[model samples]
Target chain A: MNRTRFLDSSRLTSALFWLSLVGIVTGLYAAFIYAPNEKTMGVVYRIFYFHVPSAWVAFLSFLVVFVGGIMYLRTRERRWDTLALSSAEIGVVFCAIALITGSIWGKPAWGTWWTWEPRLTTTLVLWLIYAAYLMLRRMIEEESQRARVAAVFGIVGFVDVPIVFMSIRWWRTVHPIVFTIDEIRIAPSMLAALLIALVAFTLFYLYLLIQRISLENVGHELEALKQRVA
Target chain B: MDGVKKALWIVWKDVVCELRTKETLSSMFVFALLAIVIFNFAFQLRGDERVGLIAPGVLWVAFTFAGVLGLNRSFIKEKDHGCLEGLMLCPVDRSAIYAGKALGNLAFMLLMEAIALPMFAVFFNLPVLMPSLLLVILLGTVGFAGVGTLFSAISVNTKAREVMLPILFFPVLIPIVIAAVKSTAQIFDGVSFDQSMPWINLMLAFDVIFLVVSFLSFEYVVEG
Candidate 1:
């Protein structure tokens, strides 16, 4: 059983490893080579393929955290808490990636590295919310209590996300519209590239989530072993 | 509902205690005053030209920070005296406890504002005593206090809670702060009430959404 335990985990890890490598290669080819350059923004617009996909998966991670939090509250399941924490940690990473990529895309397209545009501001807030979620988990010492508090926070924080998005959108509309994403009509190739990148990044997010949750489980086991020895 | 009565009882208890000690209110008022003074120096609105331009931002910043100071004390006061356990031991509904605490926090914030607003108006030379501005303050404070109470309860349980509350509080507060600031700015610019209607509605929506969310989720936070 002990020997098989290591083998079992590694088997899934290896499978995900190969799957991600293939998906990433295909995604890059589709985004850069197969997709046509925009008439206006030139090659700089290709960054959207990566930026938007990362943001999509990052948002997806928050949804997972939201659901996991609700489930933990309802059932008091440790697995749910574990999943929430793992996804939130990864969500922060992907959120950072999205923000950085968006900034990189912005420099060439908008002639500025940052703007208080609605989508950008909303994403920044989302990043902050999850970052604080991770901090809340660290500050609490007791296991069950930590899970409980973080779960409550996770659920409550998710509620504000949509409101933040809408309010920012309304704010921009009320004020002068600064930078609009509506102008670029997605050609067939661009649409195909977006789909490919989104699928690839989502699969990658799942791979990372599985690895993170496993690491968390191992940390739990190590702590338990240390307690037993003490 | 008994829950409503129980909740008000909690608020009454807090108010009575605050009235006697005056610790939270005094600190919040002083902190708010200091914040406004700092803003006055920081902005250095050379003359009449820039005073109105940035008065709303300064007012909201001072109020929000001072409100944070009050919120930090709200739950810590309960924890310091070990009153939280006693309250938890009660058979009353948890939502009642949440509503009650939220109301108590809101009252503290409003009281701070009641004093701070006139002072702010005098200091910044803005006409903040108007009815529309008060209404905006009321909606903004409700949303701020609603979410602030829950986070304060959560933060008080952690180390570095004084720091924790703001870290957790500020992000969730973006919409309210933005809406309030925008609405107040428009009102100050002499825009008609109809012109600022959307920002007012934004604040109202945020208040309702957060109030309901906090009310429903407070039980989970306090119990855990």
Candidate 2:
């Protein structure tokens, strides 16, 4: 189904809301209780179980913003703009959570709260780009014009994300992150927990996205209704 | 072919206007100089090792911020002076206007860089005037202006535009900035052109990608 009919359904919306809630509670248990403590990094390493998933969702949200933007530019529909705006706002929040959790994990393991690592730098850049996208949207008063401008930006910003990641990856002077999460062999149980967390977060993003888009749609309808009354 | 001609004509128009006033160039040059000098003072680049360490970052910092100053002017003038409406009245494709503005911005940025590179050498007593370094600068500037002109157009219509341009521009330009700085540093370090190939290739790829993207999207940006 197209986004409007799909996201517009009250049944699907509530289902997503309740399902995501259950998934997240289960995910918290998977992250904290089911996953084993690591040998080198110990308890701090558990943050990755959530932190990595948050980053994944943030990236997914920006991709949605990109697709939504392109579709809006093509279709000239308010619904696509709503999708873009809602996704941009949520992406920034998840990006922030990932950065914060990463920092929290970094302090105990890496001995520094922040370092110019590629993933960290790329994520920060992503955050700043989307934050600017939101800022650009807020600053413009004209609705359709705002959509056009913001869509162009949304396309450009997403295109830049991989390049941003690559350039920083090449540019970093330090040795690769000392905590080689790669070298740690994931036991089957840990892998299952990680899988559960990823699925849960993905569900949560969809639920949040549908809710936010509905709220925006209501706001659009309210404005229309107000104009009709006047 | 006609599109290129139209774009070049727009470029010519911008050049003539810029040459008449000397407004954008003078400010860009001076700002770049101040940035270079300030960086020189901040880092105290006496040793070759230290200069190699910090020069790329400082040089790009100067160019990007100064380059942005020029970029901000590219569209703001058309916008503030009501020239944008005039341009829109012309029987031209929006991409032509985009190309014209992008090229015009590129020319001004190169001119400013041409001046600043020598001054950067003098302030820091470094070998800045190498052929390889110039290529890196050109690639970097093309990439910068390619995206910069598009974004400048986008920002001029917004409120507190001065604040918005940098905010919206830099984060997206981070990849280009990193590539430019790294390539420039490698060239300065007496590395072979072959050695800096990866960074050079990165800049080239960025230049190509964004130039095409900005070109395609320019229509939506200007059309109401």
TM-score, each model?
0.95, 0.96
Q: Is the docking of candidate 1 incorrect, acceptable, medium or high quality?
A: medium
Candidate 1 per-residue C-alpha lDDT over B34-91 given as tens digits, one digit per residue, 9 for 90 to 100: 9878877887754374788888888899899999999999999899978998999999
> Global lDDT for candidate 1?
0.88
Q: Pull out the clashing pairs in model 1.
A: none
Alpha-carbon runs more than 4 Å astray in model 2 = A1-6, B47-49
lDDT of the candidates, in the order given = 0.88, 0.89
lDDT string, candidate 1, A107-209, tens digits: 9887899988888889999999999999998898988888988988888789889888988887788677666667788999888888888888887887888
- Candidate 1 residue A209 Cα shift, in angstroms, is 0.6
